[model samples]
Target: MDTLTNIRTFLTVVRAGSFSAAARTLDTVPSVITKRVDQLEHQLKVSLFTRTTRKLDLTEVGERYYPRFMTIIREIDDAFQDVTSSRHRIEEKLRIKCPTTMAIQYYGHILTDFQRSYPGIRLELLLIDRSVNPVEESFDIAIGALPTSYANVEDIPLCPLPRIIVASPTYLQEKGMPKHPSDLIHHDCLTFLAAGNRWQFQGDKGPVSVDVTARVSVNDSHVLMHAVENHLGIAIVASHIAEPSLRQGLATEILSHYPVPDLWVKALVPRNRRGNAAVEAVISWLKNASQPAPPWEQIPLSKITRQAPS
Candidate 1:
């Protein structure tokens, strides 16, 4: 990126005949222009311009390289404009990134739907817990659970990620049930402490955050779920996650009055390439994929019953 910026700077300075004039055009300081031109000269092993006390003149080498630089710059501009113009055109790679849990939980069907929607476009999905730069990594889009505020990245909420208080039927039966969020104090709350403990929620009275104490702490949701099923404690998890048990009557929803914050899944795209068609298609697809909420059977990932990988 700096290299490209430097090239443009050098070309501008040469065309303008002085660092001051170039700075005026580029809206940067004179020193910045000087460093960029100097760096560009050093990179090409030839001084691009001869600087004097009052006037600056392009060297013979500078004159020769100017056309080449302009040609390259023009090609880049044309290519970019062409790509931008083809916003509705199809038949290209649709690469996307997502968090592991989100990919399995939601996008499992979204991907299939995208493939079906755009058969000419090849879908490349990269799943990771850590967020990756879409532009830097050549990813077209991202579906992630965590929120980020990085430059050149923008987020659009895909769905509400409501966390729920879930404990397996066996566990709830043996240990009893929590009637309110505050009642978690008496239960063996099996939960992850990494994301924070104060589960803020909304009740009939308004919003409230309850500080929880966990008798059993586990990092992985899969493991924590086992502890929950075994009646080890109450586990607070996203609705999609506890869906299997909740629907099967294996797990029950607690504190329904104090609504959990909507845990949201977001689609992140390169800030610089927001309007690209390939990216736009996937973003639209992701938001619209689950027309009527998908059936759990359509997704094969284990929810509460997942032990160790088979």
Candidate 2:
């Protein structure tokens, strides 16, 4: 028996909790998985799992051995990555997580360009709206806006994404525009739940806050933008989310005199991943794409007639 392969199969089965699931992950048949596990058990002279119809449970020995095996596997994989990364060869798989709206609107081309530039690298991109702890989630990289301060991870600032108040022309026409931030209380606000229930603005005098009562409260910025476009109400959203509408003349900026606090587009990675070549390359590419003004701020509302890529 190939000890390494058998151990790998065993770990896979343990993680998957079934021979069938492990087989699917390993691209082998369930019987082959069972045989490998049986071989491993015979060699060790101990049963690793207590198998039952409903579930699989680890035996005492298995529980102790699992952590040791995990460390060995991780060290081996890291060794390979370290060697390849030193050569500047990004030939390994990379898992990335990002916001759904940003991924569709901005990163579609950036990712394509990166893939074309590095054909040996395989990419898996997962889109999510909520905050994610990259280390806890086992992601190689995470690209999104960090709403709050994060100290545990390394953050690379991509661009300034200031919030803007916008409303559809029809909605503004019907509801009338607010002259000041305080007047926003009278208008129906389409609010992003992530930004919280209050909107902040900096005017000539000082800062102002408006407690938002929403016509529609949503987590996704894109959904909130859609609601604004459909004349639901005025919304405070990221510049990128409002850009398409502002460009197409579908929505007009409100409270232009009051500037919102600047937000940012950021790239996050585990602290230990600072020197990772693949991740560094991605960060460099994203920084380049953001320079000379990012895609969101590049196109003037006057010139953009067609909708931006979804």
Candidate 3:
């Protein structure tokens, strides 16, 4: 057998955790798998696995080399696929992770449209609400509204996620409107867990931050908006989430003069996958979708305008 085949067999054995399992996966006998792994280890001059009758474990050297070997194989496979398929007909499977709220509110159609455009590409999407290590989790892409600084990962900014402070008309009517950030202390504020009680904004004087208390705190932006609509309290919500309510006159924007801080939507891609054709295509697609201005920003904020209290 060739060195490349032996190396592939060794990786399969490592992933399967046993010679028998690797054989089953490759449709061969355990002895063949064992011989292949042995050949690979001998060529490398290191014992790759610490083997036992019950289980198989990678040695220290094996653990260090595994990721490098995996990267090499991925690049080789991607190259073969690129050469064989037409430029626009690239076939690959992409594992993507995105925030649950964003996925529900925005990405449903966006992702479906991408699949339609690239029929040969298969998408496996996981909707999560927190930060995850894409490399460790084996995800091709991870999208979120927060900035990330991870080693061996590339952070690509997708768009700016502007926010607005809003409350139901009924709630504002009953509680009265606050002209300034300091006045938020008197109202029952609905806060997002990630943002906490302190809300930051920019105004004529300078940056202002208010340490307000919350009547109800939640992680989901959609839920927070729902609470605001139900007259729960005031909340700092994403512009997109609050748009519909403001347009319907169900909610009113407050502190319009004091703009809330904008969070950026970013895509986290592993360094090894940065050059991958499918990953590059998806990233390019996102950029194109968000360029000039995002879809949410396309609608005139003037349509739902509310004058700031003086």
Candidate 4:
């Protein structure tokens, strides 16, 4: 067995958690992945993985050896890059992870423009709704809003995304507008699970928090927006997600005088991989794309002429 190739295959299987998934990632068959793992275990004289019908788990030796193998692989790739990177103009493949909603709503053009500018670079974008750990997943960079800080990753802030409270004109008319945060209890609320059940706002005196009773709670902003459009309830969502509705007059802003917490869209890269050329290039593009005014705030609500859906 070729030791380096087998090691890489083994690492992929470990991270992917299944032979078939690893095979798809590696562009090979499951038999090939299985053979590589078998060969590796044979050579090492230890069972690396404990396989069952449901899932594959790493054994004691495999757990210890996994990090060591990863470090060696990274070092080898770095050495190869150090030798050939200077001769080329970013002729490398970049694996990027982003939220599905953001990719569809905002990042499509930015990514396409980058690809056009750098023809030599190949981009693989993975759109996932859940949180991702870039280092564990072996992705070059992960782009999304993070709730809190991560010690293992470096966060590069790109833009601010303010959370806003919005309701359809019909709903507000039927339920009456909330004069204060305390008034929210009397209204139907649609909540985003990513933002906790409690909603926070900055009032004239200080901060005001409301423990809301949700009519419906969903993880996807698109779904929540649809509910708001139908006059089901008021929703608190990131400004970007609510921009189209708000601009079209499908939804009207509530609590206009109060301030909501702002969430920033940031690039999260492993601390050790921050200086990689391809990663830095993408980050630079994102920063430039959001400058002066972020995409979410580019068009004022008053400028939108399209009528809201009935």
Local distance difference test, candidate 1: 0.72
Cα deviation at 96, candidate 2, in Å, is 1.1
Model 1 clash tally, residue pairs: 3
Q: Candidate 3 deviates by what RMSD?
A: 20.1
lDDT of 3 by residue, 1-310 (tens): 4887987998998888889999999999999998988888888899999988787899999999899899988899999787546545788999999887777556655787787777778999999877878999899999887655688989998898989999999999999999999999999999987667889999999999999999999888878888898898999998887887899888999999999989988889999999988999788887877777874565444453443312
Per-model TM-score on C-alpha atoms: 0.56, 0.64, 0.64, 0.63
In model 4, the Cα lDDT at residue 150 comes to 66
Over 39-140, each residue of candidate 1 has an lDDT whose tens digit, in order, gives 888888898888889988888999998899899999999998875555435778867887666666568656876777666678888777665667677777
lDDT for predicted candidate 4 compared with the true structure: 0.84
Q: Global CA lDDT of candidate 3, please?
A: 0.85
Tens-place lDDT per residue, model 4, 85-198, is: 542578789889887667766676688888877667789999876667888888788888856556688888888888889999999999999999889999999988766678
Please identify which of the two predictions, 1 or 2, would achieve the higher lDDT against the true structure.
2
From the highest lDDT down, the ranking of the candidates is 3, 4, 2, 1
Cα error, residue 278 of model 2, in Å, equals: 1.4
Candidate 3: deviation at residue 265, Å? 1.7
Q: Give the number of the best model, judged by lDDT.
A: 3
Residue-level lDDT of model 2, residues 121-178, one tens digit each, is 7789998877778888988888888665456788888888878889999998898989
In model 2, the Cα lDDT at residue 200 comes to 90
Q: Rate the local accuracy (lDDT) of all candidates.
A: 0.72, 0.82, 0.85, 0.84
Question: How many angstroms is residue 127 displaced in model 2 relative to the true structure, after the best TM-score fit?
Answer: 0.5
Any residue pairs clashing in model 1, and if so which? Answer: 152-271, 161-263, 169-250
